[model samples]
Target: MKTTFQHVNYYWDKKKEKDLKNDQIELFLYRSNILGKDLRITNYGGGNTSCKTIEKDPLTNEEVEVMWVKGSGGDIGTLTRQGIAGLYTKRLRDLKKVYKGLHDEDRMVSLFNHCIYDLNSKAPSIDTPLHGLLPFKHIDHLHPDALIAIAAAKDGEKIVKEIWGDTMGWVPWQRPGFDLALQLEKCLNDNPGIRGIVLGSHGLFTWGDTSYECYINSLEVIETASEYIHQKIKKNNTVFGGEKIQSLSKKERLEKAALLAPVLRGLCSSENQMIGHFTDNDAVMEFINSNDLLRLAPMGTSCPDHFLRTKIQPLVLDLETNEDISNTGDIVKKLTPSFEKYRQEYKEYYEQCKHKNSPAMRDPNPVIIIYPGIGMFSFAKNKQTARVASEFYINAINVMKGAEAISEYTSLPRQEAFDIEYWLLEEAKLQRMPKEKPLSRKIALVTGAGGGIGKAIADKLVKEGANVIFADIVENRLREATKSYNKDIGSYILCDVTKEEDIKNALNKTCLDYGGIDIVIHSAGLAISNPIEQTSREDWDTLQNVLVKGQFELIKQAVSVMRKQQLGGNIVSIASKNGLVSGPNNVGYGTAKAAQQHMVRLLAAELAKDKIRVNTVNPDGVIIGSKIWEGDWAEGRAKTYGIDVKDLPAHYAKRNLLNEIIYPEDIANGVFALVAILHKSTGNSINVDGGMASAFVR
Candidate 1:
């Protein structure tokens, strides 16, 4: 009989499996990748899969059994050969004789290194023994939301019996380690012919003689559990005690989210600056708008992985339906007390649960925050971490949904949650992480980032680890410019700097996309060179609008977000040497450049109290790799200098004192020095014109 599934997908393909039939490890990777493709099956970096293979022993010249399992901190969806750890099954089983008791389980983790079958293998995860000790050749351990929902239900054991009778076994809550592995062994041995076991308040485990059987067994168990929960949900009249408030329109929710994100990001980043992520998908909106939110939110999450990323509980913003969310001051006034209360409570939780050997208290700020009628906001050290945290919380919501649909939902005990959160093993893994880049937590917005100098500045910032938003007036240019970058690090938006609405929209998008802005680069401009007799009113206005007024509007809108974040910021304008030098046929462009230069000085002095630094980088004759020079500006300048357009680069280069040519990259370096290196100095112009004496600031 064929079993169809409504909740989980069966992605196995015989043709694909045949290609890797000869290689055991390759088949293991294929199975793991397919299972991890769906978040409902396993969230990012949450689950583990293992296979025992016979490999030649390099030292003995004989075959030995080696258990290959997902290494510590590796995500199964993106797992590679390097991401798997190999250990001798014999050595792992030998440790069972040395095990003193459950209290001494941590010592076994350190001993796992001694069993390494491959010297180059990654460090083994804590769950290594869980797979090694099991008799099956292939095993799968996953924290699927549907299965965890069954595991976390109050009557989880009874429900397990109803679903599979004696065909599956049940084990009570035990933190993953040597003890849990032992319990699983006992359960499987005690219940013969059982295909899997449901770990109470944790997850599910399944095993088989082959990789395909193991994969199919895991799917069957999860699919059955998901169908059971789906039927119960259909029978219920409402979920989460019915929604307490209607959801806001998509436009309203995003507008409110944009305004609230920076303030929340600033408050959460008091100890260390954070990048932000916002999600208003159906899952988040349903949970936040539910009547059960106040009751269930503080109960916290059950799965250790969920609790690790999303903390013990989220901070719930008790926003009333009548409250004015658009008023920034009102939002701040109401949220301040709630933030303070959350911090104080978090500190108390640490005091109550901490052991003498526990690590020092971490930042007390909440990682996840829920705003009713709006959406959820998550913050972390970088954009990806923040986004993943949001995804994990949504998984937690799903687990709760399934549990509450059948029986009362249950969370992990407070002390157990604390033990997992501050475990020494987790701390050691964190210490091994590489140091962050100089601009790791910073966010940047680069106008005119479609190409040339602007694109170069955006690339430099992203290289230094900042999440950048590329803003330009042209759509195709924006798409083409951002194509080469990692989608996570760089994003693009069409923006005309001359319009105030465009500037405002771009800044709002920046806050929504990456939390808030820390660095702003105004490089968008158009040049119009003309003699006094030929200069038109239209030509003068266009230059001023793009070069001067555009810079003014971008800075004006961006500063509000910076101030709200209270993290301080940097503003760099790519002005020109013509701003300082008196050049021919440059009446309109020169005046606009000069205005841009002085505006930096004025803003630097005005925004000093807010710790916002404003500066300028001036470059001249950047003829190669510049869009500005590709147009009329080059021809007009060449005409005035009595040279052909092709000779403009050489003519301009020879005139400089060093006879060096300036490129867009040189201008980018000047901006980098101002923002990344010269932190203490501002209101100064750095000339990158190859030692042009006339452009030097006196």
Candidate 2:
């Protein structure tokens, strides 16, 4: 809330020849990024800003004043001029006449479309009316948690007045609509000198002739509100941490939290499994473990903007007996019935409010889980959203603390929550979301994902909407590979797939993190080019352990979990063409791969009854982007072919009928097809080596 406005930077040139509207938009875009940078001021897409400027009406050939507001689907942090929609200001103001006679929101939207200054089809924000109604050149409304702490408390209006004196106007919680805009306009007109407005159970609004005035007004007002709430809480405070319970070390707290993570993660699983771990700082630990959680956690989100992100209520873990909290097995057993109860309560709530015209109810699975001992875990379809939910709820925790210290913490009731949760405009936005990839909801685990074929597989799986865990013995390599992919959908597991314990741990994590595995790809392999005469026991042992033994452990653990969960899965192995054909100086690596290929056939037959589809992708000379095929191995293979190391790829292609050199990504496509497309085919070997004559198998 402190004024850090002077240091914000953006590149724009006033020398450029353009209309005044261009200047207005450039300034707004720069300011929007500045405001959006700090989540304390405005979260992701939860706020809107506007400017009134003149744009030329193409049809009428007249310059007309218009209100350009942050449009729908626009993220202010990365907004462009295209993200703003210019609406004819006079025409929009005249919409008071249209809204009076019309009650249907779709028809109202059509009328709003008619008021667009240009043919720009981007829809304005849901709060555009608030900006349009108020007579200001620039305006902003943000849902800062500090402001909400004061706004969401009982007698919030009186407290707002006490803090802002006569400078701020109050609007009782009115659902954002055309009517609410009229009410805000009326309040502003009545309070002639008011510079700001605070909507009860909502957010703060400020306006000015210039962007800085409106921006600074918001900062000063929110600062005042923050100070007031902090002061009030300090005076009446019963400190949750000061001289209270016995303190546990960070390691102890983490150990305790880790014990419960899998159980909670498993309970929250649906068609797709959720991944979570312990996230605790002093703020979270102090707030979550506080005595006020029982009273403060269930009252709901401090503002409606969060309703779209966090649902109506959180699932408070009902560890019935004290012993359940300490015993991992007991907690796991207890979560089963508790989650059912939570789902049923949510179902009843859904049925209570749903009308024929209402949008379909979202899955009853709780998004936020209140864990009394550690901290809260917020569940979402992917990691990024899960993190966002955790962040917003963390902010809510502090706000609730402040409110409980001063007065009773209260947010909107269940029906208001339902209304926001199923809002037509919001539902439309979700409906408009792009179609998900083929493997959108499926969970995948890939080994040796540090680079080469495994990395390619990981990238492909993640791109197809599968949450992929990239595992390797090299932690740094795994981290580097995972970092390049979308972190939201990809994660890294550092473990040697060759180890039995590591394989078991990886499988356990997959099931715990994602509910159950849908697809598990075993791409970890080792190649050592050595003649039987020169091959030592150590070299031979390493190759067999990684290629043959590692594949066995990976699939064995995956199928065991898949069977228990009763959800059939897909298993894939990366078998080499050298396994199918005889190659010179190939003793240890070739035989191990040959064993892996045959194992796929045997397991496919055995696990077919369990509905698990098992397959192998046999690829040849896939040297492109492979760490294994780089220095010594490439030179060794080139020596066998009597060619330059760089020419090995082309040499293999010349021997193939298609004469196209295969890449690691070509192998990835074949793997994806087996799991996602070739559902009916199993016990199969799909070759991705451009029709290798020797390796071709029926």
Candidate 3:
């Protein structure tokens, strides 16, 4: 017998009918946060919820009713008052009827103008009417993975009918907004006793007379689905055979193991412990070790919300032939074939789906795949990404196994998945915000841009909408980095900042090519260690020439260019926290950097007449392996300190409140702040240290 969904209407107990306390509101918000983080249910600005706020209309001499729904770009996990946009119920319903057939953009603008809520809000949720359509005071809509898993199958309609029964109605997937709402309205009219709705390839909708009841109803529907599938798919799990574990000798392996502890820790750390559990679990191992890998293919996640917690897919590893599970060997040799096969298959799928609306192929990076016999691997910029991929893999595993047991589990045509995976509209959705908003239309010049902090600062400026000329002594490295950036966003310039003639030529060439420079980030410096006892006079000359004198020569020439162009400019020098707090090994560099910061303040005050604002960013212990962190410096510093090189990243990263390592990118973001805020205020030194040095932080 197929299990059916049953809706139980809940009400506040008479004894507990009093209004919720402040703590209760926070508790509710926290749960909302969990749901938002999981992406198992919601996405960027995709879902909405509202609480009834009744207030008296002073002029009208009557009570008014409204619901404050979340605004655009708001995620429930990080919601604030600014995220909510108030709407008058009477006016909203009236517009919903008359607003039929308008383009979504037009409909949205009309709603924004007419809605008697907050006038300052940008855009209301696309499902505003659906939430309003329910008579209940509280409403929630999420695309649950379990629900979508059952919804996307060949027998989905039958299974959903049997499970949900008459509690709710199901509508095949339609594009969201007016069309979806129209279909939903018709379904509700046809089934007056309907408790809620399930949208195919979308998500679930639930509501109640109160907020708690609505939340519980949403939870119950999925919990029952999970139980039904779990019972149906339970198997006699067994471990499959793979390569036997090979033990390495203590001395060498210990060094390698220590080198790998950070990657391992990242995989098994807090916020990512779920990956450790999934990889170590027997079912996942057996699944990976299977001869027929497709049999264990992940069922698509239960809902859209899972995407944030669980990426769109997981890697299916072939454990027997897998390499680099330890992250030591050539990953290229191990993953090359798999990468090629994925790309070939992906290209064919794109050809099959080549409609005018089809998008170009995205990076062939397989979000999830098995390494023949190894468990799995997930990819993201950070741990949160891996966590999301792991969750999707687990949920998909359960769904695929359950559906296969019931009947042949049918996968969506690879083309349909391609259409979604490479959808232009979906990609366009991400283009909603520019990567560099703070530095729009700004032109930047970065010294020492061939490596380390200079390169990082240049990249940061380019990300912030600044057209950058990355100046450095190494012409080849400068040109090599230019390939990674859009030609329109950045370019390379070879100039020795310490040479006044080289500085003048580079600035003149840049201004001639790209109009005028609006910002400059000076990061060129040379480091030499000699205790006062062993110090040499020549070492001081090189340090002064690169650190203090270099910036001064560049700024003097840049200011002359700025004055001729009649435009205000901003300059940011990358000084060190070591310049402020004394470190034992420093001899000459710190003194040079200390003088550089003071020069910045003096220049900021003098340049006020020319509208040029000067500031300096001081960062502490930024290292290589980052675009800005040089591997040589890390090794040199480690040798100098007489400690393991691997330990230095953690050593430097932990000297802060957050106990996180600082990156050159962190320092780059500081440059962005100086340029962004300098239009309003000038002549300030902003410390990007992990709280190591405290001067005025304006």
Candidate 4:
């Protein structure tokens, strides 16, 4: 049975009205922000909204403010004041004459720079001109999930005509920007009375004199379609299925909820309310128990707007377990064939539709799909996009169910569906710009990194632009480190660094996997405080194994691979300030560290021949929310220093010249600076202890 989704909520903050002034600013910012959140209405950063304002200068010059549309690359939910790039409305209208002959990229860039805004705002959205043509001040454009659903179905054009009637004008989906705007202008001139426009398989554009009116009309259009589909679609209640299930415990559910909520927040960057839903109904369970779950998973959205709402699709869960079992990597792996198939068919569809140039192919993965008994799921970047996809899915279920009530609902031809996904005009509308983060493509390895200084170096390397391998003797801890620093750039391996075989194997594996290693930070070592007289031979063996033997083994293996790359490398060791001063009851730890400090210097000289730099970061108590500081380890350390554990922070601070407790992050930064960014220095050691004014050296 085809299930339905609902538009169960709406929200507005009318009380914050006092903060706004100009109609143009208010309309533009609000609509842009809304569009940013809706996926079916927009993809990752697709879609645009705008408003025109009139401004007068002091020289008795009155001019139209033009349209302030969302800039390219900024998501609608994260749309700040700077996100909307403004352009001259009159100047834009003028471009309609000359823009035809110019290259498309130049046309947009020319318009972008001519506009005025604060120095920091996102560049103007390419669709600035389409909004410029509308008579109303506030214009809203979205690829509504419902619209996408209808468009993706069999006889989609016929369905659209039946549902929309004369309420809106329709444009065959076209490439966006100047070309799309030109197409829309032609449509407006031809159908002067039309109140709104729907770009088939693309989205809808509606406008109003006021912001709320425009917003309401946009909602109304979708709601009307939603209600129509809900009332009409029907499905049989009986099916071969499993029994109903018990509800999840509060604690269990909230944890899953938390994992997903953060992802949503990361996607949307909004403060709006969020809600989760699950079903344990018999019919739903029956559907889940069906053998067709995997086969049925790739059917895409009700509309293009689902891109903004649900992302491409939701993480479908098992009905019985209600657990997410879909492997993202597996999905990515399978998509190639589907994409190739989509591309081949798209070529034929384009040939049938027009007499023009061809568009590029898009990957095929069901952007929206029903997971058997799990009802339906939508993926979007934010709440708005999810809402849009949900609405569309509801409508799709209704229409399909309605058709099935009389006869089985037929799907659209694959070629026809492929046309929309690979539509050159729509594809052009997606954001394609790139960014340079602090870290990009460098490779680094961190030892003793289950947590603490070692873990910090691993994290920093990943953040700065390096692929990082977190190595530690604790096997479970190494796995935990990978989980903690989950990213495209992070991986982990368990290596007892003191052992030659383990060190060689780990280094060889890293080189084979990532091509080569460029930076190594040895943060693995033992820290047992003891008097020189009391320290046992066994205790000394343990200290030397990790601190001395481990460091040498790692360096030897790292240099072997690094020397081959010849790209130049950096190695950083976590030494201590105690190695520089006489501290009581610290013979074993301090002596080993002092040896490591000199070993680093010697390695720096020897490795200089191979272009691999070596350095040391002398840390002064790297304290954070790690296992070491959580219990008696912290208490013991503090007691040895004659202070409460809590006061240890202040005690360390007073010892430093800067009066700051040295964080692991600080050490991480120093390590990163010496290796990845600085580029040149080979053997220098940076003291990361906030300036310890100690004199005696080991």
Per-residue lDDT tens digits for candidate 3, residues 1-698, read: 12233322222233333433423333344445555664445443445666555666655867777766666556675766666677777777676656646345334434644765666654675666666655666667765556666765567767777877888788886545655666777888888877778876556777766556666676677666656655555542322223233323334333332232223222222221111111324445445555444543544443443433443444443333423444323333354465566556656656777777565655434555444333444543322344345556655554455555444345554445554455454555556754635665466889888877788888887776667888889888798767787545677878887799888667654543343566888887767655777568887888889888898998997776565434568888888776776666676877888889889989988999988999888887776434433445566567777878778888777766667778778888888877885566676777776776343343
Candidate 1 residue-wise lDDT, 267-327, digit = tens: 8987889999999999988899999999999999999999899889999887764467566
> How would you encode candidate 4's per-residue C-alpha lDDT over 1-698 as one tens digit per residue?
11122542243346544456545587567656665555434445555676767765334576556566777656666666767776667767777666754246445655656555334556666567778766677888765555544544555556656777766777775545677787787878887866678775566788877776676677777666555544544234432222334345544443333222222221121222122122223433343345433433234333443333433333343334365523323433343354345445534544565425545433322224333433443333222344345554444433333333332334433444444445454455554534535544356778888887788788887766566778887878888778855433577888888789888667754543343566788888657766678689998898889888889988987776554444567788888887777788888888898889899889878878767888888887766644456664467578688888878878888878888888888988888788756777866667888887782232
| Ranking of predictions according to lDDT | 1, 2, 3, 4
Q: Report the number of clashing residue pairs per model.
A: 0, 2, 36, 37
True-structure lDDT of candidate 2: 0.76
Which candidate would rank higher by TM-score, 2 or 3?
Answer: 2
RMSD of every prediction: 1.6, 4.1, 16.5, 11.6
Name every residue pair that clashes in candidate 2.
Answer: 273-514, 273-515
lDDT of 4 at 16: 45
Candidate 1 TM-score to native: 0.97
Off by over 4 Å in 1: 1-4
Pairs clashing in candidate 1?
Answer: none
lDDT (Cα atoms) of all candidates against the true structure: 0.91, 0.76, 0.61, 0.60
Looking at candidate 1, the ten consecutive residues that score lowest on lDDT are 320-329
Ten-residue region with minimum lDDT total, candidate 2: 5-14
Per-candidate TM-scores read 0.97, 0.89, 0.52, 0.55
